[model samples]
Target: MTRVCRLVAAALAITVPAGALVAKPAPKRAVAKVDWTRTFGTTSAGGYVVGNPKAKVQVIEYGSLTCPHCRHFAATAVKPLLANYVRTGKASYEFRTFVLNGIDLAATLVARCNGPAHFFPMADQLYATQPTWSGKVEKLSQADQDKLNALPQPQMMVSIAKTTGLLPIAASHGIPTAKAQQCLTSQAQADGLMQMIKGGEELGVQGTPTIFVNGKKVPAFDWASLEPFLKEAGS
Candidate 1:
């Protein structure tokens, strides 16, 4: 079996809810759900934009693909927020990735593997399962980091892609052939990522899953704390 299938099976062994059968690979559907034009950017490191173009509050989330905190936010908070706010034109959302390590870069490449249409869905899936893959490095010793760091870029990407439940065949089909590889090695994308990191720094965002509403930081993770800020912005 491929590495991806192995990682996915390992994850399912743990998280497959009681009495529920393992979920099969979803159907290969047309990329119909996304508003492609809105996702466009002048540079290579473009992100998906969802919600009302005219919404008063613009929320930009700086996430790392390998970050467990980001996964929790995606699985536990983002879905509801998107349904309640983004879909209703009350808010707009943008996801920017911070590639602090090779694993993060690999994961980012995979998330963009399926283009804009599958970007959000793939991102949600990766974050939901992040805990399983983000193994204990401190306990394992520095050798573990070396092993991860030693992998060739292509191999590293394939490994990260595996952890996200994507088969090699699926990646081949979904990812733009040249773009997939290009997105990883591109200097332009790297610069864009740096800018995002610096932008977050300037905004006083100190951690993963940090949220900003109308240029003001929401100091907590829970939506209840953030809702008040939204109300204030919307008003």
Candidate 2:
């Protein structure tokens, strides 16, 4: 890990053998630890996190769902990031939404359907299918766009979700169309997402897919540039 690693080093957790922390008696053979990759939590900054909470290395990403750079990074980085780093319990990964616009917010709400455990999978699928739907709304006539922008919360979300195909993508992830709409209309959730944008601003984030390793901003914009940094950080 880098110098920034020291900042969080104070959070170190004592290590014990697998299942040692539980009440069950020690087994004849070692019981494997629960997969850190499947574990999920929320960071104080409102980012959805996965992996060992006390991992030595920390990887945080702030990005806009509509940003092509973010999509490209997600397309390549996600699998290996989970497989090699987060899953190993050496690092944790967190994604803070950098809301760019109404469409991005709608997409995020739709992707977040079913709650935190389903968030990553829905987001992953959204990125994978981005090329298919991300551009549709952009092609709207100026008048149509004006109308969409003038609409209120749930209506705007409904229009954007339908136009961008977010509804179907959500459906594919087991979020029924009605459930997706409910997620879209959630005023509290939308406000929380907006707060995440403000949080990103406090961190001096200026663009999509910003990477922070152990609290240090790194110049990694994609998987190729990011992998080395994570590896150097003990990934």
Among all candidates shown, the one with the greatest TM-score: 2
- CA lDDT for candidate 1: 0.64
Q: Each candidate's root-mean-square deviation in Å?
A: 21.6, 17.4
- The sequence of per-residue lDDT tens digits that candidate 2 reaches over residues 1-235 is 8777865685565466897668876679876866788999887888899999999889999987888899888877867888888887888889999999888999998877776678899888778777778788889999999999899888999999999988878888889999999989999889999899888889899889888998889988667888888878773
lDDT of each: 0.64, 0.86
Clashing pairs in 2: none
Q: What is the lDDT of residue 203 in candidate 2?
A: 88
Clash pairs, candidate 1, are: 4-162
Q: Which 10-residue span in candidate 2 carries the lowest summed lDDT?
A: 7-16
Candidate 2 residues lying further than 4 Å off, grouped into runs, are 1-33
